[model samples]
Target: MPPRSDSDNVGFLVADVTRLLRAEMDRRITAAGLELNPGDARTLSHAARCGSVRQNLLAERIGVEAMTVSSSLDRLEVLGLIERQADSVDRRAKLVHVTQAGEAMLESMQPLAAGLGAEAAKGIAPADWQRFLDTLKHVRANLTAARDQLRKENAAA
Candidate 1:
């Protein structure tokens, strides 16, 4: 393959790092005998943090499709890690919440979650690391807004 242009490097580097971090997490999670795959870990963890949340909103928070989240929720529900119930206010919607068992699962994954990005910048000064994480959050917010706008436009058609 031809050499990648410098212009493409930033996105590529970010993507590579994401892939590597996930691979490491997967390895650790498996070794720990956790039943959840990475996606399930995320779904359960988010539910634990957010309390009861609508399935659609959970999908948005995790940057995944509603159907994908639904599938994971189905499996998690079977595993007794989550409970999905009809939304109290919106009968048409489902709200998912973690069960007591799920709380234990989230506790198990905490170490892996806490370590995810810290390893990549092991030597970086703490301030720079904080700034970099803050910048990434800003970028994520901007991208999420643009994505929501696009979704709104498409849904109006």
Candidate 2:
């Protein structure tokens, strides 16, 4: 088989798409006059999605350093968008929860997100979009399982 070009590589394509999408979303958020910056908006969204989660785990989920997430969380707390409470099982650890105001913020952002999604789906049919999402989910699951297997092997070595 011939070597694949960057345009033909799945990883490259995925990364490019993700980066472009994030950039566009950030631009839209700024244009929409949202008070929160992109990082803080993302932090709030992730915290809301994860419900009550530990700070370290939230950092991991957001793919950012704990300190970076901490800063975002601080800003969010000041905005009354999230609350950090002591963990019941671990007194030293804090669990992050999206406050009512955070939910409201998320709701406000829904129209922005929907508009972006609609724009992205401009050429694709509904069925094709569904299939694409399903395929991506399957690819993600395969990669996650492989990662887990590697971790287990490394632990046992």
36-140 per-residue lDDT for model 2 (tens digits): 999999999899889999999999998999999999999999999999999999999999999999999999888888999889889999999999989999999
Off by over 4 Å in 1: 1-9, 63-65, 148-157
**Cα-based lDDT at residue 96, candidate 1:** 94
**What's the CA error at residue 27 for candidate 1, in Å?**
1.3
- How far is 71's C-alpha from truth in model 1 (Å)? 2.9
Q: State the local distance difference test value for candidate 1.
A: 0.87
Which residue window of length 10 is worst by lDDT in model 2?
3-12
Q: Which stretches of candidate 2 lie over 4 Å from their true place?
A: 1-5
Write the residue-wise lDDT of candidate 1 on 48-155 in tens digits: 878999999999888899999999999999999999999989999999989999988888888876786677779999999999989989988999899989999999
Cα RMSD of all models vs. native, in order, equals 3.2, 2.3
